[model samples]
Target: MTDDKIQELIGRCAERDVLAFEQLVRQFQSYAFALAMRLLCNEEEASDAVQESFVRVWKHLDRYDRGRKFTTWLYTIVTNISLDRLRAIKRNRRLFSSRDEDPSIDDIQDERDLHEIHSNEELAGMIRALTDELPLKQRLVFTLRDLQDLSVEEVSEASGMSIGSVKTNLHYARRRIRQRMAEKYNVERLES
Candidate 1:
């Protein structure tokens, strides 16, 4: 959907128009759900977070500034909600168990020729495992910058961090992931 259309929907939504709100939800639900899934790592939890975030968005529509990007504002809400949920889960897990083994990074190397196929689900799973090892701030920056292909400024805005901090986190996150991949796959041959 176009920004103008989204803005119009937001305007109507702000006025308590139920149809416009429904339309807005349909337009942005997938994007929000994907983001929540990436952050929360479980489909059920992500769905719940997405639903809650939308409810909060509707409740706080009047606070949304028309001058800013609507999607960005919506993302901020969803991301914050997902982070809170994640933190709560982590806290609960810590309280309930002493298990500390990290999740295994899935093998992502493709058996097919690199030029023929770009299946990266395994790679994505590995990346996700590595990402899970990162601190929340670094993980958020890395996901937004590398996975989502957002600019540093956009990541900064989404994460409420400075551009420098975003850049730094992305740099380290990419470096660490690459280092892990190299160790797992044999760096010299892969490079060649």
Candidate 2:
């Protein structure tokens, strides 16, 4: 939808129009869920994050600034909520030490050779798994800029980082990811 249309929906939503709010949710829920999934890495947590984000949006519709892009605002909200959930999960895991830790890059053993992987999905999964090794800042920058295809400025806005920080983080993230991919797959042609 165009920005104008979204602005209209927001205007209606500010007036407590349930139908307009529902329409807005229908239009953006998938994008929100996808982002939450990237940030949280768990389907159930992502779903809960998305739901909580919408509730926050509903309550704060009137506070939204019209000058900013609506999707950017939505992304900011989703990113914040997902980060909160991630931190909470980390705290909970620490409290309950019996939980199985997430697998490390060394733990993933694939029988098929890299060349035998025919689908982009499989390649993406491998790369995503490697991202788990990255520091949180690097991982968020990589996921937002490379995986989510957001521009540096957009990533800065969503992640609450400066544009220079976004670029620096992205640079380091890509270098680390490329290094990991090369070590694991023994393929040196991966682009930076």
Best candidate per lDDT, number?
2
For candidate 1, report its TM-score.
0.84
Cα-based lDDT for every prediction: 0.77, 0.82
lDDT of 1 at 14: 85
Query: Per-residue lDDT for 1-192 in model 2, tens only?
Result: 988899999999999999999999999999998888877777788899999999999999887999988889999999999889887877887788633456445545743433444454444455447687687889888888887888888999999999999999899998987787678767656343
The runs of at least 3 residues in candidate 2 whose Cα sits more than 4 Å from the true structure, single-residue gaps closed, are 98-101, 111-128, 190-192
lDDT of 1: 0.77
How would you encode candidate 1's per-residue C-alpha lDDT over 148-188 as one tens digit per residue? 67677777777899988888888888788778757765444
Residue 135's lDDT in candidate 2? 78
Best candidate, TM-score-wise?
A: 2
Cα error of candidate 1 at position 5, Å:
1.6
